[model samples]
Target chain A: MGRAILTLLWKDLRVELRTKEILTTMMVLALLILVILNVAMGQNVVTVKLAASGVLWVVFTFAATLGLSRVFLVEKERGQLSGILLAPMDRSAIFLGKMIGSTILVLLVEAVALPVFVVLFNFPLGGRVGPLLLPLFLGTVGFIAVETLFSAISAQTRLREILLPLLAFPVAMPALVGAVGATAKVLDGLPLQSAAPELQLLVAFDILFVAIGLVVFEYVVEEE
Target chain B: MVQEDRRAVEARGVKKAFGRTWALRGVDLEVRPGEYLALLGPNGSGKTTLLRILATLIRPTEGNIRIFGRDPRREGEECRRLLGFVGHDSFLYGSLSVSENLHFYARLFGLPDIPARTRQVLEALGLERRAHDLVRTLSRGLQQRVAIARALLHDPILLLLDEPFTGLDAQASRSLGELLASLRQEGRAIIMATHNLNEGLEACDRAVILLDGRVARVMEGPEIRGERLREAFLATLES
Candidate 1:
């Protein structure tokens, strides 16, 4: 079961990496958002970095949604989700593989987006790397979990492009709020220890969404 | 490793319902190891629904299902390991190459020698030349062939196909028929759901006709050949 999970993840990574369509689109979206924000804020260091990271995730979340929805949506369009459902692998394994793939893609896009963000906003991320890193990882992990599960179900519907956001946003709202709170604490120069509550919220959402995805994914991927 | 007295697939009083419509009502069917069964049915006759239940993708509302002596409800993964299915939809990624798709599925099956298996499947399906072309670019016949390659990649003992001849040309269909016969020769249990009773009769050792989620009739292959099958299919549809 787990081997199939790894195989699915590997296939997604290799295919997406070679194609570079989704990743490129995401990076461009991130950079475009960063430029727009920089001009709007105009060198207000306090407001720029404080707000930029949170807002950046807003852009990343939508962009990541585009990519993540494509993950299983493409499978549905081609009817490969049915093919995969027929495979001898566990459905939870399919869920984990998709979650892992989406998580890695979002993280890759953010890795570049983060540095560009520091450059645009003129923040001292080097010294704050330890503090700043925690939010990025926790926030993305939670976002991926929530988006992946909802996207799986939405992929089956006719209005999939519109449906994913409708289903995902309500569930993802709590995670987004927790992420913004945690990142704000990090940006304000609070130690990870002081930011424990928000981090706990993020972690809690991660576990919750993952559990939900694992349990319900079978229904989402069931044959038509 | 074959278990004596083991039926390949057994479903007793299987019932599947979606909303108020009953797709399968008290369907009980079985195929012993190495037996080929042809499930003939008119449109909306529950063949697809029954196939899904056997694959463990859907559970019957009231009845029990056992595959290879393991309960699909409790041991779905174990049951899955022994079966493969292909429906009307090819269920393949349109963006990936034929080789890549097969390779990926083989890897997912955790089959030994991924590259060799990919090559073997592609060669078998006559997909060698177009191995690197994306599936979106392939014609309908080619894509369906890749679907068969995918279903057979795991070397399962029990294979189910739904209307496998839907979009094939004469040459492709003949090749597929040969492949099915070979699989039968290897003692693999095969079951197929087809609107084309002629094709189903030609392909399997046993034939069944389903009318509105019920088994209308069943006959061994030799008993339902040629014009007799055509007449039966017509009479069933009219009734």
Candidate 2:
């Protein structure tokens, strides 16, 4: 199982390295969203700082969804998912491998988007980078775990482009809300303990979805 | 070996339905070790559905399927390891080179000495010269050959091919036929679903014709001759 999971992750990364299709689109879209929001919010630094966390999530969620939707669609389009399904491993391995790949891609996009986000919003990091990384990492994993499964489920449908966001956003609302709250506290320069409630939710969300995804992903991609 | 173990595939009363429509209903079939069986039918006649079920890509809505006497429902991983499937799709990454695609599947299957196995399959398929070419840059015939090499990488006991000769020219088709004959010579049990009457009939020891998701005719040995099986196929469907 470990070897198969790693091989799948390796395959995704190797293909992406050659095409640069998913990451390039994700990064460009994230940057565009950040630039537009910065301009629209105007020169009000105080207001921007207050809204930065929510705005950041909006960028990440949309970019993450865009990338997540394509991850399975490519396999479906090329009919490679069937080939991968033929591998002699637990089907959950595919889900975990895909979720990990998505987590890495979203994080890479966030890495670039973060500096630009701070520069444009005029938000001060103030040595809070450590606290901020927690929410970003947890939040990305939480939603991606959910999105990756939905991406596989929806990739089987004809209206997958429209169906993926619809199915994912509602299921991921708790994590998204929790992530926003935690990011808000960190941006406000409050102690990380103060955001414990939201952080706890983020952690719980990550565990719940990852568990559910592993169990049900075999069924989701089974028919294909 | 046990009598059941001597059979490469055994499916009983297998039925598959998608919503209100049934693709395969009450389908019973069997193939012995070292046998080549051809499945022939019109479109929507459930050839692909049956292959997918045996491939363990999809579960039958009803009934049971066993690969080498082990049920796929209980031992899917084992069943999958014993079989290699080539559907209509090449399942190759267009951005990656031919060797890279084979290497990826080889690793996924956890084959030891990946480079040696990869090189052997490449040379066997005559893909050695084009190993470095991107899959998208290759012709459809070459891509199909690469897909076959990918299937053969794990050295499976059974091969399930669906419409493998669909779009190939005469030369490509003839070469593919030679490859299948060689694989058969090595004692692999093969179940090929094809629309090419002459190629499919000539190559199979037995042929099953499906109509409306049920086995309508089974021609064995000398009964699988070209004109006779073709007439039987048309007659079965006409009924």
Q: Every model's DockQ, to 2 decimals?
A: 0.55, 0.79
Write one digit per residue (lDDT tens) for candidate 1, span B1-239: 24336899898888888879999888878889998898888789999888888978777887888887899878887787788898888877776788888888887777899888888878888889999999889889888899989988888889988899888898988888888988888888988888886464565777778888888887875667788877877887787
What fraction of the real A-B contacts shows up in model 2? 0.84
Off-target runs (Cα >4 Å) in candidate 1 are: A35-50, A119-126, A156-159, B1-4, B128-130
For each candidate in turn, the TM-score is 0.90, 0.97
In lDDT terms, how accurate is model 2?
0.91
Clashing pairs in 2: none
- The CAPRI category of model 1 is medium
Docking class of 2: medium
Chain B TM-score for candidate 1? 0.95
State which candidate has the highest DockQ. Answer: 2
lDDT of 2 by residue, A1-224 (tens): 88888989998998999899999999999999998998899869788877889999999999999999999998998899999999888999999999999899999999999999878877768799998999989999999999999999999999987899999999999999999999999988998999999999999999999999988988899893
Q: Give the poorly placed runs of model 2, Cα more than 4 Å off.
A: B1-4
